[model samples]
Each structure stands twice: as C-alpha cells, then as structure tokens.
Target: MLISVQALRALAAWVVVCHHFMQIFFDFHATGPIGQFFTDKGAVGVDIFFVISGLVIYLSTQNKDMPAGRFMVNRIIRIVPAYWLYTAAMGLLILVAQPLMPHAAIDWTHFILSLLFIPSENPGGYGMYPTLNVGWTLNYEMLFYLLFSLVFLFEQRHRPLIVAAALFAVSEVLTRLGVISHFYRNDIVYEFLLGIAIGVFHRRGWIANGLWLPLLAIVGGLLTIYHLAPSDRLLHWGLPSAVIVLACVSLEPYFQGNRLLKVLGDCSYSVYLLHVLVLYGGWLAATRYGLNPYAVFAVCVPLIALGGWCSYQWIEKGLYLRLKDWLDKRRNDGELKALSRQEY
Candidate 1:
C-alpha cells in the first residue's frame, strides 16, 4: 500500500470526524474559523473517501485476475463485520435510551435493511440513512463493488474502469429521467468513476512527476471543493476529490515508512465507524455537566481514535483473520476430498 494513500485515508477519516464535530460546535454557537471551515469543507471527506475507494479498487486488481466471488467476499469481510457491530450498537443505543438519542430511531424492518445495505428510509426521519448513518456510504460502496465485479465476468477486452464509467453515466441519466427508479439519481457516484479514471491514467504513466502539477492539483482541488458555490457535488467535490487523489498518489514517495500515519490509516475504518457514537455519548455527558462543547469536541476526537484503535486491534483484525482462515481451511478440505475421490 502506498503510505501516502494510507496517510490520506487517515486524514480523510479525521476530516470526517471534524465535520461531524462541527455539528456539535454549531448547536452550542461556537462559530469560529475552524468550525466554519469544517462546516464548509469537512463533508468533502466523503468525496475524498469515494475517490480513494475507486482508486484502491482499481489498483487491487491491476494486471491481475481475481475471482469475483473472492473479491466480494473480501469486501464483505473487510466491511460487514465492523459495520454490523456499529449498526447494532446504534440501534441498541436508540432502544435503551430513546430520550438521549433524539437523532436516532429503531425499526425492525429498517434495521434488517441496514444490515443488508439496502437504502431504506431512516426511522429517525433522516432521509435514506441507515441506523448507522455512515453505512449509507457503504451502500454506495457495495454498489460500486457489485458493478466492478461484473468486469470479471466479461472478457478482458472490456476495461473495468471504462465499464464503471459507462455504467455510472447511463445510470445517472436513467435515474435522473425517472426511467430507472431502482437506481438513485446521485451526482456523487461520479466521484468513484473519477477515481477509476485516475487509477487508469496513473497506471498508464499519464500523470507526470512534475512538481508543479501535484502542487497545483492539490491546491486547486481544495479551492474548488471549499470555495466553489452554486456547483453540483460532482463538479465541486467529486472533481476536486479526483484531482486531490491524483496529487496524493503522485507524492507517494515522501510518505513511505511513516509508521504512525500508516497505523492511523489501518484504524481509519474503525474510527470512521465508531466516531459518531463517541461524539454522541460524549456530547450527551458533557451537556449534563455543563461542559463546554468545544472542549468536549476536542476530547472526543482522541477518545474516538483510541476506541477505534482498540476495535481495529481486537474485533476487526481478529474477525477478519478467523473468518479468512476458516474459509481457507474449508476450501483446502474440499480440494483434498476431491483429490481422494479422484484416486478412489
């Protein structure tokens, strides 16, 4: 893995954490440069995340053939366990203390839908969000994975990135025109396609190593995402996210061997999953004691990081290895049985 990519992953997750923290800041009227900045640009972390997902997926199967089933299985392993844990945690929180979590709700049907990654109305009346609101992004991710897997079924003549791009273009048009109600008409999906394009270009050596290119790309991406007004998400956030990703990939060499950043990246998923819970719980407690929201916000970020690290170390890591080993053993046992049957 590119250390730069890992660092970006870490940074992106924390940026999202900050974005959510800004919500806390706002409720307490703690408007400032930092809070306002996050209010404007913090949500772009999701854009960054979407772009990174596309880039990483492209690189995963670059110049290689991976079985679609295996690829999907790995994704499910990587995502589902932690996701389900947090979703259930949120649902449980809502159930046990309904008054404390006014922003949350629980419904048996929606809970099941959330577990299945289906886009259903949040019982909390928060649009198409799942019990764990972050899981909504995973819904998009699972869709992308399912679409990308189709490349494995077709012949090598169809490049996966091109296929993804075409699918997004067609789906967007159809969904927007109401010709396809099944697909959500969202501009954000283009962000993934942009990432795929970047990966394809990077592999083809099309992104030059010129210092000015990367610097300008990163700076321009930030400006467009943060400052551009009256623009669609695809234009402001998605395009800028793609440019930033390209810039980050270009500067990968400088970040190599950075252990702390890499560790943060490794725990990024857990941090992303668990931060809201920490924020909510901490804020609730802080309010009870009349603690300052800004101070609580500051404390919650590190606490979330610590909790994420622990979850990554024990549950996420342990579950992945156990599940992978069991699957491997089963496959091996099946192969051995087939060999014995052939001999017999």
Candidate 2:
C-alpha cells in the first residue's frame, strides 16, 4: 500500500515554518552569508508543497472510481473549510493590527480577490497583500485544483501528464514574453505531471529496482540546493524535489507502519496552518521580554510544533473527519434516492 501523502505535506509545512521563523527573528539586513542564504532558501518550501500537492492529488484520483463531480466536491470539502476559516481569522487580525503597522493602503479589490483564491493581476507588488504574505501559494494551489478537476471532468487521466507539460511550456513562454510575470506564472502543472508520471511508473513496477532512484534523488537535492536563482528557485528546485519524494515514497518499506512519522503527518496540516501565528506570537513575547532571536527559536520551535500537533488532534482532524463524513453521507443519500426513483 502507498504511504499516506499527509506525512510529506506535514514535512513541507514544518520546512515552511522554519523558513518563516528565520525571517521573523533573524536580522537578515545585518547578518552574514549564512543568514542571507537561509532567508533566500526558505521560499523553496512552497515549491516542495506544490510538487507534493500535485503528486498526492493525482494519486488520489488515479485509482478512484468516483465521478468527476464527486472528486471535485471532495477536494473542495477538504480544503475550503479550513482555508476560509484561516482567511477570515487573518482578515480580522489584519484589521486589528493595521492601526499599529501603518503600512500600505488596503486594496479592497485585491483583498477580495485573494479571499476568492484568485491570483491578483495587479502589478507593483512582490509579496502578497500586506496582511497575508503566506497566502500567495494558496492562489496557485486553488488554480491547480480547478484545472485538475476540469481534466478529471473530461475523463482524461491518461493524458493529464501531457497536458500538464504543455501548460508548463506555455507558462514559461508567457513568462519570457512578459505576458505573464515570473511571480505569477509557475510550473505547478509540470511538477504535478511529474508526480503523476511517478505514480504511473510505480504502478507498472519500473520503480521496483531501486538502482537509479538514489542517484536521481541526490542530483535533485543538489539542484535544489544550488542551481536555481532565488527568484526562479521554485521551478528549478521543484522538479528535483518531486523526483526525490516520488523515489522515497516508492521505497514504501521506510514509511510503512512508521508510527512516529505517521503521527507527524497527521498533525502536519495544523502545523502548517498555525505555525505562523505561533511564530508571530513568539516574536511579540520575545521582544517584550528582550530575548535574542536564536534564543526565541530555541524556545518557540518545539512549542509551536507541539501546539500544532494538539490543534491537529483537537481541531483540524476532528473538523475534517466530521465534515467529510457529513458531506459523503449527504451525497450517498441523494444518490440512493435518485436510484430509487429510477427503479420506480
């Protein structure tokens, strides 16, 4: 059996949490090469997430017999509830905090667009809207999810890899031509396609011989660490990360029945969602108490992880399971009623 992708997702989230903590606490402006390097590399965590998201979603759909509508419904059900909750919470936080920050004027249009999970077409900005820096990735994810759903709707699973590749090529071309900015265009489809290809290859037994897997993983890791410029790192590093993850998952033995990793994976979502809050909270407490940046990490990292695990157990997991079951039962009952009518 395939290992749960949740483990990988959680890992990616932790990577991101570390990245953000580095930014919040470390004095990037005055620090040496080491600090600069980490600050630059931290964003690569999102690329890992994109690649993993593609792979896992593709795998989930690849073998299912469900209709496309049901698949889309399930995906939306899984993501939107927690996302909307976070978005609302963040919005309120922003409103409360804006008085002190006195930063950019709030662009209501872009803010609304973000809430709807649409990528902002506006120019003159590098990061996300002032309040929600972490949200930019969600736009790409929502876009990929919609596109993937459409692909499923057409019953074209066999050709999704090809379509994904084509989309990547188009995105690259558009970026070069200045029709789309680099920040706006990405290799989401390509990374996802790579994952799908890996899944297909694994299902065919090609990966059973692990001779080349480690070599590929090493190469990918090197490219991830070195080849990509800071801005283009996602595209450059994401491919390798996807390959490494695919190879790792294919091994199966390493992950099978690993209780600790599985628990971490289960709590990953909560970790991802709540880590930023923890970091910011820590920053406030540390500054108030005159704690050093490094000292703050020493205290906050484990605390945040534990808090995330608790939130996962008490909040995310419970809410997800209950909501998922309710949605599934509702759908099943509707189907049953329809079938009965057809029998009559």
Candidate 3:
C-alpha cells in the first residue's frame, strides 16, 4: 500500500515536471502533438496529487493522536524549510541573473507571500503565481492543511466523514456564492474528497485486491480524459485523477514497488519544488550551446532528478529530522516539568 502511494507520488511529481518543461520550453499551444499531450497529462498530475494528499492525510491520521495544532505544525515543518530555501535560491538567482529569466523579477511582496504560502499575482505577468512559480500549488496545499487540521477535533472514525462532508459543504457553498478563489474554490478541492473516499475504502478493505481491475480503471479514466477538452478541469481532469488515485490505492497490496520510482517518490516534494529551477537553468545552458529541444530534455530530467534527490537528503530529510528531534525533546522536557510541578 505504501509502495503504491509512493510510486504515485513519484509519478505525479515527474508528470508535472514534464508538463512544465514542455510549457516553459515551448509556446502555450504547442505546435506538436507530444507537447500538447504532455501539457494535458501534466494538469492531471496535480489533480492526482490533491487526491493522494487527502488519502494520505486520512490514512495517516486515522486512529492517531494528532492534535490540530500539532498537525499544522508538522505540516509546516515538513513543507516550509525546503520551500523557503528554494524560494530564497530563486530570489538570489533573479537578483544576479535577471537577464536569464526575463519574466521573473524580485517583487518583494510576491516573494514574501510565496514564503508564507499565500497566493498572489506574479510580477512575471503570470497569473496568481508565487515567486517560485511551482509554489502556487503549495499555497493550495497550505490551505488544505489548514482546513484538514480542523478535523482533528473529531474522533478518529468520524474524522474522515467530517473531511468529506465539510469539504463538500465548503465546495458547494463556494460554488453557490460564486467565490472567486482560483486557488481553492469549486471542484478542484473535491479531488481531495475523492482521495478521502479512496482512503476510507482502503481502510475498510472495501476495495477488491487485484492488478487488472485497478489498471483497467486507470487506463479507461485516462483515455476518457484524453478525448475531453481541458475546460471544466475538475470534471475533465479531476474525476479521472480521482479514478486513477482510487485505482492506485486499490492495487497497493498487490503491486511490487519499483525502487527508483519509490526513491523519486521519497523525494517527490523536492522534485516538484526544484524541477523548475533545473528546467530554467537547463534552458539557458541549452540555448547557450545551441542544443536542441531533445538535448535539453535529456539533460534537464537527469539534473532535476539528481538535484531533487540531493535536496531531499540534505534539506528535506536532514533538516526535518533535526527540527523534529528538537521539537520532540522540547515537548518531552515541558511535559516532565509540568509533571514535576504537579508532584510538588
């Protein structure tokens, strides 16, 4: 089960990596079929991520003593350090090499918002992008974490139900109010609910174990998505994304995980965060050497993967462990002091 989820995490991260590379390297409407295909598939990856997130959260927190504040703090500690590091790196790059990335600029407000995981209009003329363009999704993720934290108030068994009901209610109300949040309103958010549903099914053993059935669902859902237009993205992409996630979770026990894919999955956050920088730098280097798009592709992915791995080891894993240990010790010490005072 863990392997399948990890593999999906790897898959989702790379899909987005390829998707952005195609978009950034070429025009918005790609002249070629491959570009357009990747672009279409890439968007689905994000939707898949949302679904997976909900599923993971439910699965992890179920029957666990995770307080709302603790949940938020853990999420913050896990996400913010690496994100801020990368964002600062990006800011430094913009300061030094403004000519390389024409659209990218040092808009202080945007940079601050990016660090805070607040969505803002990009100074680069990109719509509602944070300083690190990919961090836009992090903004949504932060919001989701916040909302999910509230469910901690409920009992373990009841939390999943609250998640589904609360998310659905909020989504429906936002839809009715015509609230204009490109970040978290409407159907996109429901992808998480789809994930929560999958988690419930998996936890309850309701899903039949198998390869063929889940594989078929994935293939069929993707095929349906391939034919549809990108409009009403939730229906077109989100539904299929959920279907894919559900299938993946269903196949968890049966599927033997690939080592490389699992490694990538372990570094999935780093992959998603750092790939853009690799792509950007690769583009500049490729052009400098008169390397073609294929060469650029060849070089970019390996570097991105390598960089993500390194970043994961050092910043994400290393820093995270240190912070978590320190936090745990502080908590333990505080508890001891309180106990001692009560004894007195």
Candidate 4:
C-alpha cells in the first residue's frame, strides 16, 4: 500500500469527524472559521475515501484470479463485523435514549435496510441517512464491491467496461424513478468509477512517475477544498480525490510509511465508524456541564481520535483476527474432507 494513501485515509477520516462535530454539535453559521472551513469542505473527505476504495480494491487483485465467493467473503469480513457491531449498538442507544435524542427516531424498516446496506428512502423521512448516519456510504461501498467482483467472473480486460456500464445504468434508473432522494442516486457512484479509472491508468503505466506528482496532488486537493460547497459533492470533491489518488500512486515509489500515520490508516475504518458515538457522548457531557459549543468541539476532536484508536484495538482488530482464523480453519477442514474422500 502507498504510504501517502494511508496518510490520506487518516486525514480524510479526521476531516469527516471534525466536519460532523462542527455541524452537529456547533452551529455551522455561528462557530467562526473552524466551522466555516470544515462545514464547507469536510465532505470532500468522503470523496477521498471513495477514490481510495477504488484504488485499493482494484490494485489488490492485480495478477490474481480470486474466486468471487472468496473475494466477497474477504470484503464482508473486513466491513460487516465492525459495522454491524456499531449499528446494533447505535440502535440500542436510540432505543434507550429516544426522548433525549429526539432528532434520531428509529424506524424498524430503516433499521433493517441499514443493516442490509440497502439504499432506500429513509422511512423516517430525515434524508437518506440510516439509523447510523455514516452507513449511507457503506451502501455505496457494498455496491461497488458487487460491481467490481465481475473481474472474477469475466476476463479482466472486459471488467472496466462492464463495471462502469453497470454503475451508470443503476444510477440512471434510480435517479429516474424519483422514489428515493437524490442522495441515493448513482451520481456519487461515479466517484468509484473515477478511482477505477485511476487504477486502470496506473496499471497501464500511463500516469507519469515524477517529482511533479506530489506538487499536483497538493495544489489540486487545495483547490478542490477551496471551491467545495454543500452541493455537487461528486464533481467538486471526486475530481480532486482522483487527482490526489493519482499523485499518491505516481509518487508511491518515493514515499515511505510513517509509523504513526500508518497506524492511523490501519485504524481509519474504526475512526470513521466510531467517531459519531464519541461526538454524541461528548455533546451530552458538554450540555450537562453548560460548556460552550466551541470548547466542546475542541475537546471532542481529540476525544474522537482516542475513541477510534480504542475501538480499532478492542473491536475491529479482535473481530477481524477471530473471523480470519475461523475461515482458515474452515478451509482446511474442507480440504481435508476432499482428500479423505479421494483416499477412500
């Protein structure tokens, strides 16, 4: 993995954590520069995430012929365990604290849909956000995984076209139906496609490896953030994400991983999943103590990072290892049974 890409993962997760903290805990309009900057540009972090997903997912399969079932198992193992744990926890919290958190009403339909990673019009009518707000992005990630798995079923040369077309078709149908909100549309799906394009180009040796790569990445990322707004996240944020990803891949040969940044990157998924719980807890504490919102925001930023690291260590890592071990054992058992049958 590219060190730069890992650094970006940590950076993007923090950007989103701060953005949500500022907007949800502190009023965006009144919180001064911190609010203004993060509120305006924070969502680009998700774009960065999507692009990274594309690059990493595509690159991982290079020169390999993985079974589609096995490919999906690995993806599910990586994503579902941590997500389901947090989702069930959030649902339990909402159940117990319904009166205290009026803004978060639980709908059984929405809850089930969220657990399934299916995009739907939220039965609660509070936008397309699920029981846990961050799960919306997971819907896209799962969709991309499903689409990208085509390489296992078809020739790799034909996969880019197949996946791209499938993405376009799905988004067009959903957008045309008007049943779901635009947030659930395929517009954002293009970001994953952008990442796929980056991977394809990189593998083809089309992207130049040079000193200029880093410079372009920095400038493009800055300009993207400077122009970012509440709308058009796909274009405004996605394009720059591609640029940065391209730069990162191009300069990968020159970069070495920083221990701290690599650790944060390893924990980025946990950070993204668990930060909201930390933010909510901190907000409750702040309100009880009558602390100013900005002070709460200042405190929550570091607290969220701490919470993420802890979750990574205790929840994500443990679950992943246990699941992986069980899977390896299962595979060994299946192989043993086949050999025994042959011997008989």
Per-residue lDDT of model 2, residues 160-257, tens digit only: 65447546755677668877446546544466666666766766777764546765775667566665665545456766677666766655665678
Model 3, TM vs. native: 0.93
lDDT of 3 by residue, 1-344 (tens): 37788898888898888898887677456777878888766767788888888888878887778778888988888899999988998888788778867888877888898898876688878688887888877776787788889887877777767776766765667646756354556567777877888888888889877888999999989898899876787788888888888888778776565777578688998989988888877777776788787688898888888889999999888988899899989999999999999999
In terms of TM-score, the best-performing candidate is: 3
Highest lDDT, which number? 1
Worst window of 10 by summed lDDT in candidate 1: 22-31
Using alpha carbons, what is the TM-score of model 2?
0.82
Between 3 and 4, whose TM-score is larger? 3
lDDT of each: 0.82, 0.65, 0.81, 0.80
lDDT of candidate 1 over 9-98, digit per residue (tens): 889999988888767546524357777787777888888889888888888787767788888897898789999999999888779878
- Give TM per candidate: 0.92, 0.82, 0.93, 0.91
Rank candidates, lDDT, best first: 1, 3, 4, 2
Q: RMSD, each candidate, Å?
A: 2.3, 3.8, 2.2, 2.5
CA lDDT, candidate 3, residue 260 = 72
Model 3 stretches with alpha carbons more than 4 Å out: 168-182
lDDT of 3: 0.81
**Count: clashes, candidate 3:** 0
Better of 2 and 3 by TM-score: 3
lDDT of 4 by residue, 1-344 (tens): 77878888898999998888876676456357767888778778888899899888988887789888888888898898889888888888778776767777787888898898876666556677777788899988998898778777788888778888877766787557874446546567788888888888989989887777577777877786687663776777778788887887777666675678778888899889878877787777777788886677778777777877887877778777888899989999999999999999
